[model samples]
Target: MKMNLSCCLYLAMAFFSGPATIFALAPENEVTLHPTTWLGENKITAVHLPKGRTRRLYFTLKKKADLMSVTVSPCAVPIEWSLAVRTLKDKPPKKSHWTSKKSMPEVWWKGSGREVKIYTYTGNAVDTYTGPAYAPASIYILRLKSNERDTQVSAYLHEGPGPSGVFPELPPDPRVHTLGVGMTSVTLSWAPSSSVVVEEGQRGNRPYYEYCVLVNPKHNHRSLCAVREGSKKDENEQMRPGKELKKDWWWHQPDTPEDNESSSALWDNFEDPGCVCKDTESVCTVSDLLPDTQYYFDVFVVDKVNGTSVPYTGTFARTHEEARPAVTPLREGQVKWVNLNGDASSQNGERSFRFKPRGWQQNGLLTMHTCNGTGKVKVTVSTKGQELTTQEVGHELAQIWLHGGPSYLIQLQASHSDKSRFCLRMQASSAYHRRAVPVFPAMLQIKSFNRLRTCNSVTIAWMGTEERSLYCVYRRQIPHGSGKHSSTDRCLDPESRPASERVLCKYFQELDPRRAVTTAVISELDPGVLYVFDVYLMRRWGLPIKYHSKTLRTKSEC
Candidate 1:
């Protein structure tokens, strides 16, 4: 019989991405608890040095985290240097303490001078200076000897992005509100985010960070920020050097002494300006709103030094009819699990479950009840053929954080015994459904489809013609045979192939050049199985284009 498989409709919606500013911190990133401000009181200017004598910077290290390197601003001059360490009781490094040899790597091209602490880089630049192997959690002195006495030197001892540095996760601020909802307008205010950036060991803290507030009046497609900058350029063009931009705004680097103020009033100590209840300048106000007009307010935080943090979680406000229900809620639809080896989920049986999410469903879990057997029985749940969760099913119930796709597969494997079977039940809740309109494929398709199976994963590369667009990748395993078993030990073929296997899709948005070639590495795949890849491209203004790959098999793990 000819099997007709229905394709799974994978929603690569922007809703799930939440915010672009929410970036995960890497292992190397650390937070500084007690950092000392650099150039704290010294306002040194660029001048020529007549230096038989040296100007040494003595720094107190706070956090026990060892020094990776010190980053220097105003990197225009060259300084010969050495490092010395002393306890709180010891004096600064004199001629005697600098006898140690070179221990850290030095690259003269960047900024390092003859010695490890000696750095030479050409003005107002940014470079990381080498540090010794062991910088204890005490006071360390940096001695600088420059030929020209008038070298511009502004330095920072960083532990991380600093107190007001880059956020580890996204921002949780600005839990929004629709304030002063009147017939003609409404005000949107979020929790005030601190503009003061703390490079605890850097120069003065800046206080003049801008807020990018986007207001989308309901029943309209146009969107604009209430406080537009003077450039009148695209949101992406603005920059405060070393800062990042998001959907709403971009903060250029804050370099000027005048534009940057002493956030020390708030950073070193708390100094709250008296609250003015009539203030709407900090908040975004969308005027000319129709009565009961619905609107969405999203505020983004831009730091003059570090960059942009995630936008505040958005809020929906309306004029008069101040409430709108457009955000979709995930509904727990029916979940069906089928044993691949037999009708029952016995030991060593591989089963698959299909779920049709009625609305928004993500970061959810499927609770399964199992009979505790001897030894250890491992149960693994896979979504879109990628292992999502794996654990020993020893308790009466086992649950894991399940990332939603089109379908789910639960496989039961026994280590020693194979007599007992497992059972599963549903314990999901229903939420308001926010159905989003479907997006169609565009007109520009990708070509040069190639796949390479390396180690445990497959890497795919392709080229597209669209620019300034987003691309979505979809892939899924083509199950070889039906999980059902015949009277004999052989597995039966599936009754009509599942219309297009449940797609395992991923999204890559705002690609730098949509017209250029792109590549994505897909890992944790079931080795030796044939899989299909589909690349979809959506341009800023044109329709989307879709391309499919030939059946590609990954190298088996021997």
Candidate 2:
């Protein structure tokens, strides 16, 4: 009696679903040995075993046989079940317990599924069954048990020298390729397995084949991908049953101490993302990947019904790095307007600028204002390789204080993916104050000199001749007991002096030379040493006028 494709599918579906109705009526402790008609016959039988229950089956050989094999295939569900087999001479134990090894018959062989056990008769006196007439017919008893939940299983009995190939062969290795790579996602495509069509033609029904895409960190030995229950699509496309296929499809390398040393190379710190696609769909997109990272991609074809899978074919791809524009140079006291209207903007919507204030413009403010964009812009200010402040600004102005000397990094990143226009203005805070008239005096002098001394530093305050003028303070150590007082006639520019006699020069802008006392601190001075300090009023056109020299001494070591 041959069954058509529809009948076979209906029978398979009924076999998987029919057990639920009889589950309540079946006795939990019943042990019945359902028998096959003759030996060396290939026969499959299905049984419904409730949770924490056991089922016994047997096949008898009229003549001595060299081999006896039994295979048990459980339902395609995430449940635990085991199979045990033994050969009995007369009858099985009346009250055999599945868990007690002593109470049950001695097991001749044990396996999960698709495994065969062979026995050969040796011509020796100790060999009990050396020939067909040496012993009575043998009975093979197969005991199966299910755990956690009610399970339906199919048992195949064979009395032969080899297996009958009850399970289907693994499909061909998939040829995987990358479709698109991104910072946090990767799109992949592959050709459908040809075996699916071939097998459906031969078997008269569609075989149960599932495809899974596994992603592992490059060069990693341990696998972080696992299949769990309800992870696959169900018949209704809502809730499907799933189980862990064989581990042969996973990529594994030698795990030495050297390989496990780096935490970044392992999946412990990150998620190893993967996905499952049907035989009809050849493309899938895996998300939540790290940027600028290399990964190994493996595509597996699993026989979901038989719990069999073949080795995977894999390839490697690297995600693209985050997009950023080149650092733009920003000039002090100037307003720069950036129009991200066309191709000038970065593709990732980020921009950065480098700014360094002039030596005289120490106290300044940096302002960022978005003029055309609707959403806010994220502004980050950093100086000397350290972040100073960050703010989100829109049409409202965002401002931060800027100091001179050290270069500053200002980054402007958009909060949304829309074309934007923004302006950055950097100006000295004093720019808002009243300006003093440019005046040149015939002579300049340093008046009202006072000093405060520390163990390694000295602070000197004086009144200069003109405001808004640049001053250069020079310091020189006097030789011990030399009593040499430096004269203004011999004073030279710090850069023009000889290497050995070059003095330290510090430049200060006298913003309020008339009212505010100009102060300068000279630090890292030698203790118990006298030093001479001279203030020069620098003139761009002519020679700088030198003020009276003053001597000061740092305190002795504490």
Candidate 3:
């Protein structure tokens, strides 16, 4: 079915400003060095600096130098640090002659670990700098003194004057502010990543970046497969770990961070097609998730810079056993369940549950929670009772994929004679496919609002959203007879007034061409009278999405 998706584009609010330009890679000329003291133990070793040389850096550009400045980012330092930049002249400038003296700036990506400083230079002019000009052949010197021993640093010498030789760093790590955990979907929203200014002529540094999302099952949604019971045999009451699929268990990783114990093998890596963005945009919804399962979401932010941010653990969410459609507002905890085989005579007898889905895009899943009696439950579902799947139900939740279709029946029966009551539930979700939704579509927009044939006749087009089956075009003459673009400045509900007092035009959508879209027109009104037109897309589910209004006057019939 054709569904409107335009409404979803502007639903997110950015936490930070969008990115400016892309930072692909560091300049071709880059170097990373660790300073050493001559008195250090490794002084004579291959890595030691000369003795008595407290803190200094002497390096020559391997290639002819361009108008560039160097940025130094210290590594693994626990305290604050400061450094000075200088152009080493033939006479070797004294320590006090350094330019651009200041403490390094802190990087708050996740939390500040290291500090970085940028030393800029412009020909003849020491822009934001206090030192000499940058010549083609000039030796650079840096002096650093911090409580920390052996100042180790990574430096990037960005070639020639880029815009202010400064750009905003990677947007800070995104925080998941809103989360929708559905049986088969996880919708998330976060503030936009901050913007960065690139070199001259570069408008969008990094067009967009995507989140690398990975999930790990906190544990089985239901209790692990039942342990065979018996003390010694029956009394020993021995239970064993659930023999779930490798994908079901936590990944095993031999190497972990100092304090982290989670193994890498248990994690499920998902390529979130929705989470990818080319611009300063935030918000994504991931579908096709499992229900009743605990999942830890880990996300990494990748931006214009060639490097990727450290994985920031996201919220822990669990999918429900059932999903309620968003079309109509149903009472809380209200569920529609169809009886398959309501016969509850014996616990071992087959009990069937069935669900009819409204939309063709809906997929079905059956979940059963069996308590007390440890027993294996075999299930079959489809329009016909042909497919079969098995699960151990004693004291745990067992799920069966119904290979969704029109109407599916789920039949569950205990493998043995044990009496167990199976609490049943079903899940259904719509598979939405829309064309080219923008990374950020909130730039006050309407597909097109234009005056048709006459000022009194107008037509408007806008992006369609999921299940928005109807469009309402309403117009009421502006009070005080204001001209087009004048401030009508009032909220008048057209639906509240008499039919003659307002013109309400309803339009049904046609088959979409590329993206979901719809248009409606209003005509035959009095000529030259000022009017205000408001458009609302009536959704099949949930609330109607309203677009901005247009104020116009019909050309006078005179």
Per-residue lDDT of 126-219 in model 2, one digit per residue for the tens? 1111112113323344555666566555556555564344433333544578899999788887766655555556866444554557765633
Once superposed on the true structure, which residue ranges of model 1 sit more than 4 Å away at CA?
1-173, 194-207, 217-284, 290-293, 305-310, 321-558
Residue 439 error for model 1, in Å? 54
Candidate ranking under lDDT, highest first, comes to 2, 1, 3
Write the residue-wise lDDT of candidate 3 on 390-440 in tens digits.
545433333344443565655555556534343333233222332221121
For all predictions, the C-alpha RMSD in Å is 36.1, 21.8, 36.3
lDDT for predicted candidate 3 compared with the true structure: 0.39
Q: Indicate whether candidate 1 or candidate 2 has the larger TM-score.
A: 2
> Which prediction has the highest TM-score against the true structure?
2
Per-candidate local distance difference test: 0.42, 0.52, 0.39
List where candidate 3 sits over 4 angstroms from the true fold. Answer: 1-173, 196-208, 211-281, 298-301, 304-313, 321-558
